[model samples]
Target: MSSSETRPDQPVITGATRLYAIVGDPIAQAKSPAVYNALLAAAGRNAVLVPWLLSTADFDAGLRGLLRAGNVDGLVFTYPHKQAALPFADVVHSRARQVGATNALRRRLDGRWEADMFDGVGLVRALEDVGTSPGGRTIWLVGAGGAGGAIAFALAEAGASQIHLTDVEADKATGIAVSVAKAFPGVIVSLAPPSLETVSILINATPVGLSDADGLPVALDDALPASLTVVDIVPREATRLLDLARASGCRTVGGAAMVAGQAAAVLDYFGETAA
Candidate 1:
């Protein structure tokens, strides 16, 4: 059947289909299954992506069990597990190595596993799609966790002149800055409190905008500069930050863009091991 005609309720999974899963503690909120299933169908691949809700205690055993299933070809890792999943991989890509996290994994022909991270790369691609390039731009990035750190590294790699990282945990931001500075000697990387002044781009990689009750990542009394570009990686169609940025006359990129950009890279990675 053509991809356009395929319904989510009627996905043609069977005994011969190859299986892939996205693992997370609270898996219900993940958009991976719907996004990936459509991609697989569009690519004419006989594979399915499912969600596996696993707690911290069961993660290792559950993942090992999945890997042992001959039909399971790969797994995607999410919150509370991206870093933990790294040790299980036989090979770690340079990007994941630098970020100290892995968001996707694929099985190789030799029965070994390879892992890589796409969070930063995906955000960069999303920015580029909208005609914004990090090259020579000054960026103030908040939240130096897995996603934020990956993005800081990517921006530096993409030729950003300067990056100021900050998080609730000062050490996490400092650590990410140290790694980025070491990796890109020419780029200026430092840790600082979040601010909008003198920065061409502002990014919030935190969970602050996930709910209406959540506070803004950065305080704003009035409108921001029209020249500023704001981005939030909260995986929502319209986050409070994005809404505020729009009202303030600043250009904005929402979480959906980041997800869409990463979805392509993720599906391509999965296809490499498709049965």
Candidate 2:
């Protein structure tokens, strides 16, 4: 799939079409449908990726039902489901093995599901596209959840100098910090609050800012420095944080770019991208 062709518009669904679902709680914010459907159309593939709003409790049953369907080709997991989707896969890709998360899973012809993670790679690619490579840059990442943890490791792998992490669950953030620190001994990882003092990049990897009621995920100064590169992976064209960053003359990359980046890789993984 060419990421350039992806849009939210629904494509023609037919009896012969294959199916893909993006499973998660609070699934309204997902861009996978928009990102994948357009690509499927562009590639001339008879497939569609839809969103499945499964609560934490129903995830197992919901996933089982989806997998039971013969035409359901693959699944794109988000937020809480990334780690949860791992055990369902018979084969785990190296990236998923390293990150301990699986954001995308494909059904093999042999009737087994294979899993892999691409969130961190997508975020890294998105940052690089905006000329804000993570290498040697100190970063403050919000959310030590599935996507955040993967991004943390990927940043370290991309040669980030230091990473400061914060999450609603303190233990989860600490765990992610320790894991990243252990894997990339050269990169410094800290369990710190959101502070722009020594940080050149601030990333919101959580779903905190999806609704107006959620407000800003992290508080920022009245005027942010232009040197900071702010990224919000909310999949919205504009989140309050991104707007604030833009207002302050800081470089901002919204969640759409990250979705687009992942669309390229994950569609290829699904064998839906055109050669």
Candidate 3:
């Protein structure tokens, strides 16, 4: 619709100015810049990922400008903007199409935007990195919002035998559960908070650990089974819930794994694999 491009206040020749960025309404808290900068340097690329703040009405315009810039290879999309970027892409990866959202956008050789959704793939990949496989494993997932829904879908696709999803919103949880059951007919699906039983994996996709949100998404009375692999998708440096899970002798994965995995996928969308 409308676009704004970033350029030096004055034109200058430089070899260190290749560009990448993460787009969102509130970019202040994003860890992408820190992570991507390190990754780029590790790869010996003259590029960095920065934060871009744009209003909902301006997302399209802001993205157009970013893609048109010669220096920016791609941009990672974040909350409130991921679903909106879909129509602008010339190509939509299958995951994005299935999820009805795009979390990464890259500029093609033809100069058109192509997009993909990587949250679920990232989660599954991160789990595998920690020696846990969703296949044949029973997983209990909390929160059925966008990230949670995507995670549920990924687990189903990864051959999870059973999945139980819970959200503050019953309808949302029910909707995702139905979708999971329909998508993977053999997988058992249910609604409600997870019971501390034989579930091999526990995933918390809610923002409870963030913003000082009181109460963990999983119930306090719940004792995490030592055999269970736990993952929390909150990107804070440290989280009490994750600490508790570890202190209880459960194998735990932090939010950073999900963030790195997602960033890897986003980098892939830019046609560059992680080093």
Candidate number achieving the greatest lDDT relative to the actual structure: 2
Q: Candidate 2: which pairs clash?
A: 1-273
> What is the alpha-carbon lDDT for the whole of candidate 3?
0.78
Ranking by lDDT: 2, 1, 3
Q: Residues 97-131, candidate 2, lDDT per residue (tens digit)?
A: 87788999998878788998999999999999999
What value does the lDDT take at residue 204 in candidate 2?
97
RMSD of each: 3.1, 3.7, 6.3
> Tens digits of per-residue lDDT for model 1 on 93-192?
9999999988899998888999999999889998888778999999999988788888998999999998989888898888889999999998998776
**TM-score for each of the candidates:** 0.92, 0.92, 0.83
Candidate 1: residue pairs that collide: none
lDDT of each: 0.85, 0.87, 0.78
Kindly indicate the candidate among 2 and 3 with the higher lDDT: 2
